[model samples]
Target chain A: MDLILTPNITDPDGFYARLIAAHDGLSDEESAALNARLILVLANQIGNAAVLEQALALAQVGK
Target chain B: MLNDRYSLAFKLYPYERSSDQDAAQPVRHPVVIVGGGPIGIATALDLGQQGIPVLVLDDHEGIGMGSRAICFAKRTLEIADRYGCGRPMVEKGVVWNLGKVFHEDRQIYDFNLLPEAGHKYPAFINLQQPYFERFMVERVRELQATGTPIEIRGKNRLDAIEVRDDHVVLDIMTPEGPYRIEADWLIGCDGASSPLRGMMGLDFEGRVFQDSFLIADIRMHNDDFPTERWFWFEPTHGAGASTLLHKQPDDVWRVDFQIGWNVDRKEEMKEENIRRRLDAFLGEGLGYDIVWSSIYTFQCRRMKRFRHGRVLFAGDSAHQVSPFGARGANSGMQDVDNLGWKLGLVLKEQAPESLMDSYDTERCFAADENILNSSRSTDFITPKSKISHTFRNAVLQLAEKHAFARPLVNSGRLSLPCVYDNGPLNGEDALPEAPARTRPGAPCPDAPLADGFVLDRLGGDFVLLTIDADAPEQLDVGGIALRRVKLSVNDDATGALAERYLGGATSAVLLIRPDQHVAARWAAFDESAVRRAVGHACGKE
Candidate 1:
């Protein structure tokens, strides 16, 4: 499986706005649940679990 | 002030005898609902709304007394709303979508449930079971005032049921004595310790957790806590395991503290023990009064089949899951949603009796899904093996620092509506590129419409929803007598409906069943295709 490392944002501001809009009126617990679901859906679309693990490891660097 | 004439602020309803046992003849009814809990009453009200006469039998007269089953999911509220009791719960219940996970006071991750919008109800609400039951009773009484009265015979315990080939004969023990009643169909919503199931020798099979948790409902003058569900794993307060905080209506805050299985039940439930635990959960020196506290052990078990000849089971009688995910009442409501319309149609001879089997195949599948999730949560929370505990601790530690590990930490999976993808009732869709979210088997996703949401237009009958096209004048939908609803969609008025239902296509028609599950779909309007799908859905094929 190949990971898409290209610059993917068409409208960064719009994407940022949509991301913020998703969190609107949601509490901390609900936000956590939403994040979990997001990770899962994105993982399924990504298809390859090995690539997902690598991407997750990369994203978690220096956190 | 405590005189007999004085009006009490609230009182437990006195059980009244609805049947005179001395009467010579046996009373006959179309439907007999055992146990008048939320599930039974909801089913009764739903059936009654469709002009079906139902008799509800229960040992208790009033609503449940605790702040039990606190988290009502969006799907449940939607079903309640459709059945005439949803808005009140949303109005009064604490509607929240955020949650914070703390592994020993360190914040891990947060989530938003309904991120992409278009739903009328929130993702979840913290409404107690009592309020839900009261709201259902109110709806039943309100319907009764308008002449469609569902007879609820309180204090009438179903002593024994003699199952017949055609119908069921129930020997009910009332406060006045015993009486025999006959029913064309008997629905057991009698809950976890269902005597009806016991009488029929049906056994519930699944996992039972070895841990018992103490739920304390506390009332205080001033207690400030966040509305979101706050879950703690090995926190500074309380003894190990997991703890949860949820605020119900009124000044009551429900705190669940996991107590190990070996402890004495009575000793643990003592006021001093409860107070000590509360001190650990909330800080010491807090001014609060204990409203109610109960110790309960959760088990995820279910019957092999919900349907038995002329007798059907709904709610806890059919399936029970650990209370962590709020799956019990929510799933029961889904059972009501899945079964009510089919049962009503079958009683009316609109659909074949075999249509009822779909209820078993569909809901039992849902029950298994719920049980599996709840069991996983239980194992995570109270790890049995040494390696399991180490792994849980490691996950908790890593979750605080990483985004990926955050999803692995299971406080509770939380209840979501089940998608019946592989059920026998669904038809094969021809269009592969169509939106799978609203596919043939999936529960119809709530899309924004001009008048109301898409699901609001469904529920009562077989609806043919056409997007960016026109439905034919009429469909000769075979021998089945289902009321066909034609919803003509104009995309210029509503933006999301076309994108959500039709995908990129210009036109499509979806055959939505009475329970709001999509039975079939078509790229274009064809009468023969629609009729075949409808026939298949109603078990007429």
Candidate 2:
């Protein structure tokens, strides 16, 4: 299953940025796996199908 | 009992020839503060900075142990900045703008603290409390270095306190000998079990939870965790199940585990018991030594009143909270911040002593709100009944799906600062009815100035903010020192400036106090009303 993650400006950026920054140091496969996990976790958090759809669209555009 | 661990050497003067000589000897400083802990030191520092002579008495030969309060809020930093400690604190501290909330191994929400860049200071910084104290002590020493005459009497203990209307007499037992000193004011910054508060017959009213938490400082080598705070709710640990991991300086981590109250008091804090909990979380084979470990029960309480006569209560002596929200130390520092400048003003006779009453009114409001939020958070985490457990689970489940539920579910209430709506100092004409987005009573929200520094960075004393000039000359608010800045009246800049300094505003004039709370604000400058409000707040009228 595919999942998407959307970052909000109001949410604390320090924690999220640090997490992403740490992920940058990982190997591509490791980073991809972690990203997939994060997307699933965030998608589970959002719960709304429309919001998830928007997040997925944004995720694909980034890719 | 006064061995190497607690020895003192005193210089004694030769005995006088007559009783008249002893009687004629010059009096020492009126007030002598005992304990160089943050509270004691802060009181002495504020008094000394106000040109009042003070002798700080401490038993320890040097500073205390461990990091203690590593999280410095923007408001606390602003207060420290006033005594020339803020810059050094900001310099040495690690600025963090985010925190991640986790449910066991799953990440529920991530918060970005750096929402807008215009504020002078960041949301918070992680700095060891000892170093922060050292910075404050150095500032105190610098004042003395200039021959300002503030003395820190270490290796001394308080034997007795005698309260007199004209002065507070202290019987201090030093290495030299027993001595008597007197002071016009006495402040207790002596922690939760403050002797001074007890001496004044002030009752600390609040609840102490039965559950105890063990805090362990460990050197972590985890690659997955970021250099940010992580809270794991209902972790698969012991009977009481939550874990808090916070990043500190020097690659150290402060982790807290909630253990139920039923454990044997003697054996519950043992290394074996601690290791068992650590093993449950980190799994086997992760080698790390616990630098420090201690267990403490959480208390949610505040003194009925912060002041009685010239004696004032600050920090833990005045109020306390569960460590669940990290509000305890931060709130204490805020008490010092609120009381420090006012004490300075009153000591200098610039403001009436009645202004001191606002400290009780304002700080009590802050303390109560902090306790309420922290207690609520504690209850949510440690649900007491099956119904509460179900409610909590349902909220979490809803938070996973609803954007509207995220703030409540993620416990953002803990992070939001309290506003003083019903404060005696707040005026009816002031923007009291402003929405939460544009609240008039809160500490000015941090925002970036066009000059690149944050607006909050300009704090440490009263600030005059002039958002726009529908009538610039009409902006005169008497009795309050005003600094005026003109920005676009109706534009995004107004929103940005409003959010930064006063939350949200189209055009207004704001008078910000030293503690960063909005002392008075006007939708548009009505000079006389502003002056009257300032007069009312400062007790000049």
Candidate 3:
């Protein structure tokens, strides 16, 4: 797979809450570390290098 | 009822009494079309020019007033050209190829739809829907003068239809009274609110957007705006959430404002309210007359099947999409283009009735594609959720300086011809290295030939086109003659023909259909393979 940018989430609000709760009691440095680790895990799960590169490029667009 | 703005411009088809009214029994015709709109008239022109007698019944005496569906794509013009009426449309239209997108009054990026061209028509033209219909009706009248056997009865409305296995019985309501008529086949182009579809008890299902847009066409003598499509998202003028501006002919401009979902439609369409919005967007004291205004809400929906027994549906009666990409009328013309020849063949006994099934399969596929695209554009333009809105704004802001994010900023994808990727009528595709744009199940792209254009000669019949490839001058398979058109890449002044038709292959042979879609293509011509592909295209295999 390719990067699917459409609205594919089944429960967006619930996922958002869960994501926010993950950083609950962590320092700023810990929260940044957690975000880094999360990105790596998802990228590894995707597996395809081209798709990972596309996601990387898209994430860096506004920067 | 047509508004008093502009209805008496041309009474193209006046209500005239026909001898069929006084007939002892119901008169049986080969084909009867309901709706004198562009699609119905184009279908009539297609069938009548092929010597098929057609009768068109319309509720109105002439075209209704409105500049609805202004952007006609290139493929639509090409199809109209084959119907002998593309000249006036292209001539009278205000052609536009450039589009600019702005985010909150800051110009982000711009695009040119036709950067390189060796084609006959532009990427798109902005023409009012009424003029488009009037030109086609004029073509019908011209063909009638030469006795082509196409009759359009004004003020004739289809009250009900009885679909039979072999024919359809129609009850038409005229001003004088109602009359009964029998048709071998009935075509419904009666538009989105199709009475024929309603009477048949069909399901038209899809997504309805929770948004509304107000269209105000104004007339003023000024050169303030260029002939380009300009779109803005959350304008600084606070006109609306989003807005679009386009220039049409005769000093008229089409302005569309995305008025939010929960508003009084009547209050929004008031003259003073419209003027307020226009004044904010265009600046005060512009001094323009409101030619016409309407508030519209769109849905991305379509029927389950375009064909049901003897009655078939073309145009908006069968499908609909948000007017974002201008896919409504353009796709409808393509439906007529695809169905016209297949229906013609079935009527002539040259092809089996099963051929009509391909029309349903292919046009439905096209409708789904159109719906998916327009829906995506709508979601981008009008974000439903907060997170989605943030993403949209971020994409737009990044698009100003970042090339990578430019394609992500979706104002509207714009209308393009749909390719039947997995259509049932498609045959073998042996030219693996050939350009995918000219491969099987794709509409043939036009190229400038020595005489004129490639599309000018390919449509209206089966063409066996050979480029640096050897094939018979003519091939007759299953009573269908495939005329050979031999041409070389040297015939073109530019090398666009070779680039579009042949990628790396030295020679190519393409079997083109009557609608100018590539049925099959091969590196070399094999008589048996050609015959089988021809048979397959005719629904004989």
Candidate 4:
């Protein structure tokens, strides 16, 4: 199972706004905790281990 | 019975007047090493044993007090073994390979540094810096007694130096009076606060972490604590933020407390205050006497260039790192190992002067590697920002339950010798099928031979190590002779040599440098290729 790197989300800006709105009323630590849980949830959804590893490597690149 | 800086282990080289001090004209020596610390003395031993005349000058008469650098890594021992002084150190040192890490009051994980067998030395030995120096100094004395051209003058301090195109003229201050001497080559092993570096108007460039650690070496007989490194983060004992405990030789233990910055250093140094903290940490029942104590703030820094004209710096004189990893003295020993052969070859006119530049190149690269690892360890140990602290704690918390996060928990990554992978002196790494541990530019991994170890056969000269392979008995390339050390799998009783050297391949040929770094290797012997590698290693290519 390959990661869908292309524009897969039909409402990209709407999803990003929703992601930001999730942390709107939270403190930095609370926001960080939320992000961590969200990452785990999203990671579980993308259950393919190799694809997740590749995604991690790609995300870490050029930082 | 507290031993301070004035405490002496061996007053080996007391103040003695030399005839050269009364010479009408300043006497010129082949090589003069400043600061008779471990690095300086090791450099002298390396050069002196190679039939090179070297002089060592030190301000102090002998080893200073305290177990300053108590952790001697295997590589350092291996290098010392090459100079014929490792056995005493290992005999007198407290050897340990296990380290247990704790988060708050709970043990998160433990690590064994060397899990496998067949290596000559242990993972690490906790010997006091004074003992380490004494062993090397004893070796120096033995060499001198055997008529090796090595002279050590205690109380002879280097006051000033004049650097020229080919030589260095140094003015000395002694208990008697002032004297002058010149050197064809000068080495600055003067340590972290290098007087020679200051005399040359040079300074290190890097980060200074805003934290201080207090090291207390106490003589205590405690049956509860095993001979292993035990570290605690956010220790529940009402001590400092973090604490370290290790066993040394002679019923001594070194305890380090990570006292935060912006505190009165003098107040912290007071014995009553120190004991107040220690008593809280160790509890009241334990009886112990303070052997030595010192406060240290580390900096991960290095000189811009290790080599400046005729002057060369090794050890702390060249670079410094946080003591977290034991990289400080271990890396300095490596610098001596690297520079000794290069400098020897240049002095003998066997290798080009450009080969000396590779010392700067390789060691500066190594220094940066040390600085990077130590700096990262420091950052992890003492997180600067709140987010970093949160992440650090998070990693520790997760490491308690998850194996994946255990690797991320950095409680000072132990010192390992740096591989000069991209070294300019490295030749073709043709043994792609062989073990990467024995690849070109990597330090030769020790393996058990039938009677002894593989590392014992190498060092001090070019060795053409061929395992289950055929090569010429010897090859002389550009006046440098490569002696062949032929070994077969049948000779390897434990099969470690075969596994470490050959891997999947049946045969291997490796050209090892005098420093025991693999210059190049092949699946089979090839004369021209070996010659090319030797030439390349000598900076002729």
* Interface root-mean-square deviation, each candidate: 13.6, 14.3, 8.9, 13.3
Give candidate 1's root-mean-square deviation (CA, Å).
8.6
lDDT of 1 by residue, A1-63 (tens): 655544354643234335445665766677667768988998898888789888787656634
Candidate 3: regions farther than 4 A off: A1-63, B1-9
Query: At residue B39, what lDDT does model 2 achieve?
Result: 68
lDDT of 4 by residue, B305-397 (tens): 999989999999899999988999999999999999999999999988888899999999999888877877777788776656766787677
TM-score each candidate.
0.86, 0.78, 0.91, 0.90
User: Given the true complex, what DockQ would model 2 score?
Assistant: 0.02
True contacts kept of 4: 0.00
True-contact fraction per candidate equals 0.00, 0.00, 0.07, 0.00
- Candidate 1 lDDT tens digits, B1-541: 1113222222334556554466578878899999888899999988999899998987766665777788898888888988888999999898666788887766677766655577777877888788888888888888989988598876678888899987999898766677898999999999998989999999898887888899999987676766677889988775446788878888688889888888899998899989998887778788899988889987899999999999999999999999868899999999999999889889988788998899999999999989877876777788765445655786677667655456666777778878887787887686566788888777777776666777777766688877655676456565444444444446236556766777766677788887788888878777777778887888775
Angstrom error at residue B240, model 1: 4.3
Model 4 RMSD to the real structure? 6.8
lDDT rank, highest first?
A: 3, 4, 1, 2
1 or 3: which has the higher lDDT? 3
Question: Against the hidden true structure, what lDDT does model 2 obtain?
Answer: 0.66
Q: Which stretches of candidate 2 lie over 4 Å from their true place?
A: A1-63, B1-34, B96-98, B104-114, B147-149, B221-224, B237-240, B397-405, B410-417, B428-440, B452-463, B470-495, B498-506, B523-527
| Two-chain DockQ for each candidate model | 0.04, 0.02, 0.10, 0.05
Ranking 2 against 3 by lDDT, winner: 3
Minimum summed lDDT over a 10-residue window in model 2 chain A is located at A1-10
Candidate 3 has which clashing residue pairs, if any? Answer: none
